[model samples]
Target: MARMPHTRAAAHPRYEALLAEWNELLRRCQSTAAAQEDAPDPAPYGRELLDRWGEPQRRYHTLDHLSEVLTRTTELAAYAHDPDTVALAAWFHDAVYRPDRSENEQRSADLARRALAEAGVDADRTSEVVRLVLLTVIHDPAPGDADGEVLCDADLAVLAGDPASYAAYAAAVRDEYAFVPDADFRSGRAAVLRQLLDLPHLFRTPYGQDHWERTARRNLTTELELLEA
Candidate 1:
């Protein structure tokens, strides 16, 4: 069957104009946020690779994840002592994510440093950004500074979110390792969940502790049960 062209010319023009306006809004936001003293100009140094593949096929750590983390980090920063550094840390935490690579954090931090240099951000601030990005490793969550703690908390905030969002996050994580066997994936994932449950508190921030600790416990318990079963 032949497809009809969009028949309402005036309506089509209006819709196209609206879409252009919406895109402009997003561009301005990214530019403004990236230009913040704390935020590195996000233009160069690694976007082409992600964009080369196009959307929908994009993996777990897309610009969407960056935006969400940034938004949460901003909120959490209010409670933090070094809000600027925390915000910068959030911007670069996942600046370089590769599911197949084990050195993602290190690589992301490198990219962040380069961006910071290009933006003329201070050397001390760049070093702090690097430290904050690496803290996401979670093998040892001993964040040396308040900014690091806030960034770490923001990154994992989804884990303590509503069950629906938590479930979605779990699925996305599993998808990140889709090549792995289901049993192996479950075992590895359950280990991480167990670690969170065993923590004195998964979140150090008072807000996180209050809002997320209980829900995170419940989710961890449930997920662990599924793994055991």
Candidate 2:
């Protein structure tokens, strides 16, 4: 794997901590892939993943977002049928992001499938990872899809974070779409927020429903009002 420059400094303890966790997740995923079959090493793929997450164009969907999803996955892992798979999904869900692209999720899923296969992961598990990545597009998993529910909920967990963090996230998202004209960006963003608001439940996992639903609604409502204004 090509080494990417480590731009994050130790002064940011949270970024350092998340980097550590990201490394551990990569190690665990590599080990699991190795157990499936003897093939090309997965470490390089993991490095590539980290590099992609560090892309300069990303704002809200950077390594910080990945780390948050991974953290939430850890908290909700107990409810997943295969926690490892869910974690893997979280890692690659936004791996191929592009603010102007409609195929980001599809491309990300394809990347997950190819990388997992190269890592020697079996077809079924790889397929599941792809499915989980695709689920992020609409964030609607089928009923009783425990792993899907966990991954999706974790991905959206930031929506329920504290007001300051949520504000930062919203700003970052706007920055990602900075290429768009202000009025267009506001209209598109408002549409997306309304769609989320229309959902019967913003989160699927029992843990998410119990802990995040109320706050997530409050946050979304607040953002939607601002966007509409």
Determine the backbone clash count of candidate 2: 0
Model 2 segments more than 4 A misplaced: 1-39
Compared with the true structure, what per-residue lDDT tens digits does model 2 show for residues 1-229? 3556445422334655555665565456554547666556555666577778878889999887887888899999999999988988998999988999999999999998888777767788889899999999988888999999999899999999899989999999999999999999999998988888898888999889999999999999999898887
Best by lDDT: 2
Task: Give the TM-score (vs. native) of candidate 1.
Answer: 0.74
lDDT of each: 0.64, 0.83
The residue ranges of model 1 lying beyond 4 angstroms of the native Cα positions read 1-58, 139-144
Worst 10 residues of 1 by lDDT: 1-10
Supply the TM-score for candidate 2: 0.88
